[model samples]
Target: MPGDGPRRGDAFEHDIQVGALRPAFEAAGLELVEIDWRAPLDDFEGLSLVLLGTAWDYQDHPREFVTRLEELGERGIIVCNPPPVVRWNAEKRYLRELERRGVAIVPTVWLDDAGHGDVAAAMNQFGTDRVVVKRQVGAGGLRQHSFSRDAMPDQDWRMGRPCMVQPFLPSVVEEGEYTFLFIDGEFSHGVLKRAAQGEYRIQSLYGGYETDFTPSAEDLAGAKAVVAALPFDDLLYCRIDMARLHSGELAVMEAEAIEPYLYPEQGPGLGERLAKAIVARL
Candidate 1:
């Protein structure tokens, strides 16, 4: 597993995902080593498998990250979630692909060399005055920002960098983000994460917190449909993030097929379940 960001206290300090998996993996007669994806390594030879852990820094060097994963794959070391899947999902543009597949997604507009009029166009397209801007290939809320259509600045970021513009979903701050975890394509657990007061980002790094959530039948059905709409089967792990719309419908915010944080602590026996999933695949 790959780890990055501020490391203080114990090595597994705030890493519940790794902390939970370690014991279960060892119990299954396997050794687990957590490695930072950004660290220099000659090769991935000698490894049974490489799980893409919280490689939060990958957005800074996506090509290098994919190259490393490819190296591991060519060396016969299985990369969970698979390298091809990572390549496809690493970019936010996959949301557009999902929309094309009939999965409900937040209305979005892809932009490159955007001008002042493009902002208004996005607002008009989504029928909303506020919009969220995000990089095409980013994670952990890298460079994600919200701006009023009329208040957006003429910045150089919109010139060459690729980004997507979407109407700001107020439900994120009102209802919260719902996440469903699937191990080996089987549902494992679901959690609700709320942003900090007056904030929109729901990651803990942004002071958000997780809590228990009971999804409606519609929620489950909608999420299931989205999962089935994906092109692959037999994924090692996946996290589907949904938002409750004003009309009480669930819209996919993201289908994390890569290094999504699986909050094992939120569900009983989830770590063991994940371990079983991995062992079964091996």
Candidate 2:
């Protein structure tokens, strides 16, 4: 696992996942090593599999980080989900492609420093009373905000960073968020994430809670289609996050291909299943 460092006190999820995965890999005759994701690229040599685990710093310098991984891929190193997958998934614009392919996705508008003026126009088209403005490339609910149509911040807010504007779906408050965990394109488990009392972001860092959830046949089928549409042929694992729209339709919120938190706390054998998947790929 390539992360910041050894798990700390508040990082219980990180500890549990790394701890469980380490023993599972050992029992299967594979040696598991934990490295800092921000370590120099030179350290990756001789490593068989590079799991792009957590390193918030990498997300901030994604282009450089992914470039290094791509170089490693050229030498036949196996990077879970792969570098191309990471490059594509890192940008929020991928949502547009999914929508064009006939997948249901939350309506989104992209804004760079040059496109700040378009925010109002785009939000008007989505026809929502409130919209969410978030950095185009971010994780864990960092730098995300909700704003009413009449209360957008000044253009200075978009001066140095690219942002995405999406209409706030009221259904998030009513039906909670659903995340489907898949290993090698097959269903493993699902979870329902409820945000803290009045917040809309469902990240645990933001006081959200997740519980094992069973999806309806329709929800399961929809989630499957979203994953199947991705271009990866050897995707080791992924988490597909979704939320209901005002029209009672499921829409893709995010496709977490890099270091998504797999809620193994929900079941006893989930970690074992994931280890088996990794072994099959090896």
Candidate 3:
């Protein structure tokens, strides 16, 4: 697996899945080595596969990251989730494409370049007083911010870049978001993630907590449709996160195919299942 090496301030250096997944790979008769993605790849000559375990810092240097991934592809190294899937999922605009294919997505108004006036326009377009704005390419809730039409607009989240704005769904606070885990298009497990009290972000790094969840039939149907609507179907793994809106319908919060945190706690031996799925892909 290609991952980030220990750094003094690297937030994902302590990812537990790296260690947790080692045994599964071994059991599958494959050798697993965690290599620093930024380091030289001279030692990976015999490596059969490269799975992105926790290269969370890819967003820090997206151009270089994509370049390296392309280089690996040119060298005939197998990359899980595929390069097209990574390129598409790395940006949030994929939600719009999903919506076009009849997948229910949280209502969004994309801005090529957002300004204070654009934020106001987005609120009007969304027909809501409050909206959430986030950069097109980001993780860990970075650059995500909420703005209220009643209060001063905080366009800082845009950071003078392309952004997408959506209505703030109260469901995120009222009831947690549901995440459906899939390996090779097969559903494996589900988890419910809730933000800390008085918070809106549901990432564990932000004090959010995840718990095992049993999806209702409606939720399962919705999640399945979302996955089916993906542009590509041979993804090694995917995590579809959805929230129940006030309208009593589920809206996709994200259909992450690239490096989503697979909550192994929800399903014991999930890494084994993932390892097997990856091996089958090869």
In order of appearance, the predictions have TM-scores of 0.91, 0.89, 0.92
Q: Top TM-score: which candidate number?
A: 3
The residue-level lDDT of candidate 2 at 178 comes to: 93
**What stretches of model 3 exceed 4 Å from their correct place?**
1-14, 154-158
Candidate 1 global TM-score: 0.91
Candidate 1 residue-wise lDDT, 1-282, digit = tens = 334455633224237877788888899988887667766654455887888887766777888889888888887888888888888888878888888899998777888646556777888887888988888887777577787856885754353478888788899999899998888877788899999997899987677888987677778888887788777885888899998766778899889998888877677677788788777767
Model 2, 29-116: lDDT tens per residue? 8787777765676777788877765554566889987887787787677888788888988987788787877889988877774243
Best-first order by TM-score: 3, 1, 2
User: Candidate 3: how large is its RMSD?
Assistant: 2.4
Give lDDT tens digits, candidate 3, residues 102-173.
998998888877777877888888778888888888877877788786674655634477788888998998
Quality of model 1 by C-alpha lDDT: 0.79
List residue ranges in candidate 1 displaced over 4 A. 1-14, 40-43, 155-159
lDDT, residue 255, model 2:
85
Model 2 stretches astray by more than 4 angstroms:
1-10, 114-117
